[model samples]
Target: MVDNPKESAGRCAQVAGWLTAACQAGHTLLSEPEAKAVLQAYGIPIVETRIALTEDEAVQQAEQLGSPVVLKLLSPTITHKSRMGGVRLVLRTAEEVRQAYRAVAEAAERQAGAGQMQGVTVQPMVTLEGYKLIVGSFCDPQFGPVLLFGSGGRLVEVRRDTALALPPLTTTLARRLLERTRIFTALQHGAAGLPAVDLAALERLLVRFSLLIVEQPLIRECDINPVLAAGDHLLALDARIVLHSIDVPEIALPRLAIRPYPSHYLEN
Candidate 1:
């Protein structure tokens, strides 16, 4: 997104530090909030999330954000929160927030045992008016960076509607990736009285996704699912980032099966 050099450098340091810390701790999976931080720093829009360490704190945070926010258990050991009943949605009042907090607390305890339970994450509940799409990439042992885009949300695995493209995507390349998907037709034309989503916005995110993978090879894999594409808005509702181990130095680029198109040579 054309950030200045200073901003870019700060982002580099922050992301590198997070990756390093996680690898040093012998962890590959970053918590949702942690992954969102990396995405936000890279200019990808995400719902700002806050952590509540206690029941009262959860209620207060929920009240401040107003009614109908979401509360999910936060734990380094638990990633599939929904599967573990650690997610509470559409909570409307202080009492509801308190109850939800306790519910997720129990869930976390059950999943991770006693002292392993962490706090809960609080984020405003945003309505899904348009398509919930997934934008992500992985370091392919052969192709280097491979980008992915498709239907997200609960139907992700069941539907299996997705497309892949090599990294360093231009607007044209991004559009081509989207077109390969089955839902792209419906996304382009109004379907079942629903209007088409903003293709330009999705294309922009796709391009940014490619650049993110290009610049930050430490990100071994990433998934920004349910990126709510309502009108012109593209906010990542949830993200998961997996980092390369510390054995792979952040400065060294992973060997790619194919040499990337050297666009930098055109500049200087």
Candidate 2:
């Protein structure tokens, strides 16, 4: 669970008090937006996105992103976009954008009914080399926040090679976390002369994500699947977070004020 120290400290204090009250009231979960906002505050790089209520606003946002954008229906009522064709990609023109937006909205409305509709999200397209990375967290019944990192994208569920770590991860542990993955050997020195990824940056992302889970106990599961590495910079292109019941136990979350990530680890 991670939070922005300055911005969230007050909220955390408030939530702490709320949790105490909720415990007394017999309540246990937090809402989805609340979980997402908390994670975003913790420095997890979510994609550049905007919630648009009207078609005109969606077109404006798509144009601003410079065409070739992705649009998806944003409804808590519906979970699987692929199943319902609620996602549209590679939209290059304003006409195409409008069509995509209307299509998704209509689909969501039809499938989930009118009140379940909550507009759409227009996001920028991310380019990448090699494979996508996924970082996820799940609150284990006994252990609390358990973080997982792995190869992702459409084939993530099929491949299923990944690594796991506990909270408050150190730099060394971060490196080891990558190594434990089956794809590490290929990523380090893979076919066709692909340069090694910035392991240090990857570590930082992992540590930061872990910290995010520690800080936001309201989050039941958070997944950044397909964190694309384009050249040197990494970008999280897609994400999903599930909120937990507010009644979840209040554990002492881990802190992430470690030394700056080692510069040398990325040089090689």
Candidate 3:
């Protein structure tokens, strides 16, 4: 859950400072864990992941996350994971996770090139009976911050069921944005015998995500793909944030079209 707006603002400021340091150090993308941390701070539900340096460590992490886990090769150089065959899903046992760890690591090294391989990450498999959605935000050269929603998954590129809105969205506006998308139509009317998806929960998630962008101006782009929606639950399966290397002036309000996160309340 999210804290009070003031506290949330403080946390976002803290995260932005850390990311700015990374940007200064020549990092453009936040690693999975770092992205999840930002999302967690904003009260988004994300898949828990742990870095495993070895096969034994991978098995241990899988055990810790519980059975039916997933293994992915974590690397700075490997941007498109599925294309490189760097992802393994549905490892139900420790041995299976161990084997998957080695395979994914080796493949990542081969595909991503030497010295580009980081350790593998262990994540619990998320099984949902509802739609997979995408939620994201980006800085437009002309429009400042823009929020996006759509159908998402392995074939998201092909489907292209997306809608866009400006940041600092109200609940009503966010709902309208969702309603504009084709997936939202399916979600509203029910799909494949599944009951109508939880629009209220999804709306709340989108609103929070918008506020997160308003709070953190350094974020150039963010992707929360396959936001699993089943019944009244929504979970972020995979996420990433891209940072820009521009210096931000310390002002009361950021230079955004929308009202940025209110940091003034933090003093009180």
lDDT of 1 by residue, 124-240 (tens): 999767788888888776677778899888679999999988877888988999999998987888576668888988888888777778777778889888888776778999888
For model 3, residues 1-268, the per-residue Cα lDDT tens digits are 2457667658878888878887888787877878888898888998888888778888888888898998877787665677888889999998898788778877877776677777887898987687888998887777887889999988889998999998888778889999898887788889888778888888889888988888787788899987888888888888888887645544522356766445454443
TM-scores for candidates 1 onward, in order = 0.89, 0.77, 0.90
Give, for candidate 1, the lowest lDDT window spanning 10 residues: 259-268
Better of 1 and 2 by lDDT: 1
Please rank every candidate by lDDT, starting with the best: 1, 3, 2
Best by TM-score: 3
Model 1: how far residue 236 lies from native, Å:
0.5
Deviation from native of the Cα of residue 144 in model 3, angstroms: 1.8
Query: Which residue pairs clash within candidate 3?
Result: none
Q: What lDDT does the true structure give each of the candidates?
A: 0.82, 0.68, 0.81
Q: Report the C-alpha displacement of residue 268, candidate 2, in angstroms.
A: 26
